[model samples]
Target: MEEFSVRHRRFVANYFAGKVKELRFQLAIVVAGCDKSLSTFTSGGEVSRDNHQAVLYGFSAFTNVIQTLKDAVKTVTNEQLDWSKIERLRHGSFMRNVRNAATHDGNPVISGWADGRYFVPSKIVRIDGFGKTIEIPAPAEDVRAICLDFAEDFCLLLRETLIAAGGIEHLKGSKFSIEEVEDAFANSTFIPPFAKELFAQNREKIEADLKDLKHDPIADAVKELGEVIQYCDSVKGD
Candidate 1:
């Protein structure tokens, strides 16, 4: 039984590390695509078909990340994660519906429509299928934003669950250490390797554009965990 526990923790640590890397790559794609698509939409230009496809791809990626996090928590703690308790995910049905509509129904296209009262044109990705019509904000930036929030909340929940289930000591033999995990969570930038050159070339403008749109859920998660770890260490020292 002890041997099994050791092997299980090792497997989980390695699996989670790999999954995080993949999810970060997916997030990079989503962020870059959204930036371009949103710029086009905001400038009153029609979003290109390629950009529309990218947004759909991002939706699929975001859905995958949510499922992966839920599975990871269950695997680590042997308890199901209650998605409804997750604030960002509680209202995420629309995103799942959008993914289903995009995959099963016809492709959702970016369309511009005026707000009811304001009459200012805004973009939306709309699709009709599965006995319903689903519309999500254009460029799918909201989807990306919600996914970031969900990931952070899920991490904090998993941390608490792990501590309750016997604490991080149980993961001793695993490749994941508390410090390493904290570092990963602290580095929230999600730029992919292929985009490095492009990002470097436009760093100034991109940074300026994203200044108001910065989201740092991962950093928030790390900060909370750091506080808990500090308290635990202090208690042990006393």
Candidate 2:
């Protein structure tokens, strides 16, 4: 089933790439919509407006990434790999909170005269035991960048995971990659499209026969000769 495997891989790649494109577009739309909504605010009003959308988009994007990572983890076939070590699921609700504080809850907005440039309020969000709120005046860029970083990492880990699962460890001792398995399909005697697929379907049987022949050549040849004789005798009698 070399032909089938090749076609299947192509389909998977195309399928995932389409998904990536769609999600990225959705994220962009979220950002754009937030920016558009904030644009209507005048001067000081824009401060709260920008902060609100920044927090809104950041939290939504982080949540979307978390969900996507969870879905990608389910697609892998390898049981030996520790998905936990690489998966982002461990990040928990804390990640969303980080975005929230950096984006919302009055921490991200600073009370001041309006500046023309769009700003992200990063500092000015700390609560003490005495129940006092403080504003740090930190830059908004930091929060936006952090959320974006998480999103990018999610995309990378998901792709790497599925690729790792397709490992052809059966070829390990032979110093062969799946390349040899591919070569088996490439043999012209096997025929096109159907050839590789046929071999893939019968690989276990073919491998067993090969193993027998390698270890017991005399017996294998004798068996072949006997089969030839039986075939000739049957044809003659008929």
Candidate 3:
């Protein structure tokens, strides 16, 4: 993560957010433990599913979303965003692990419509598996929805990062995640005023981010405020 101007930080963060929402809406919801599902069953009618897929699926959006979020941190921190512990951020652990399970167990798609905010988790459940019942978190409609909304936030984090880092060219087209994005953004020293153009030079980045507004992460840009993102090294050195 390189140091970023205010405007560039916000630009990338918001961009990936939109993509996350659109992708969440597209995932298909299906029940798990059903026969003929993607996960294969065992010869003795006992099947074991690789929950890793669910983990990967859940974070797929987030990881991609974060590619740019690093920029948000760099813009403020003037250093690299720490990817070592990205999964440690609040609400990220349970959700990422949980959604992976859902996807693995055949809960193809999980979504929420309540509270005018929706998020989907990759649904996975263990039924008829060879081992004991896996205690995956019970799917709550609200959690699902918030997950989607949070995904959008990640998009914002991504856009800010990318723009701060001088766009996808710096990322080398690598995919990032929401968790990574927000974590990096959280580490910055210059949080853009939500919905306010914090950096005049970043206007072009903002426009580029806007051009690909497929996720619509910021319901209202003017109202959205940027944060003072700082890096781990910055703080540790402080």
1-238 in candidate 2: lDDT tens per residue? 1123433333333344445554555444444444444464533343455555554554555455445434433432222334354344333233434434544443433222223333344444566446777544444343333334444555555545554554422211222224456575686664688777877888777665544432322222223333433432343221
- Model 3 over residues 1-238: C-alpha lDDT tens digits? 2456644545554553444343333221111212212234323332333332343354444333344444444543355655444444434444454544544454434333222222344344455346666544535444333344444444344435434543433322213334444444556666665523333445556555544545423322212322212211122221
Q: Cα RMSD (Å) per model?
A: 16.1, 22.5, 17.8
Best by TM-score: 1
For candidate 2, the lDDT comes to 0.43
Q: What ranges in model 3 sit over 4 Å off?
A: 1-91, 103-105, 108-136, 139-144, 166-238
Candidate with top lDDT is: 1
Candidate 2 ranges with C-alpha deviation above 4 Å: 1-18, 30-58, 78-141, 167-238
Q: Which 10-residue window in model 3 sums to the lowest lDDT?
A: 27-36
Report lDDT per candidate. Answer: 0.50, 0.43, 0.39
lDDT by residue (tens digit), candidate 1, 82-191: 65555344335544444454555544432332221111023434545444555654333354354444444454565565556543344444244344444444554674
TM-score of each: 0.49, 0.35, 0.29
Kindly report which residue pairs in candidate 2 clash with one another: 1-196, 1-197, 1-200, 2-196, 2-197, 120-140, 123-136, 123-138, 124-135, 124-136
Task: State the displacement of the C-alpha of residue 73, model 1, in Å, after optimal TM-score superposition.
Answer: 1.4
- The segments of candidate 1 whose C-alpha lies over 4 angstroms from its true place after superposition are 1-6, 43-46, 87-90, 93-144, 174-238
lDDT at position 66, candidate 2: 47
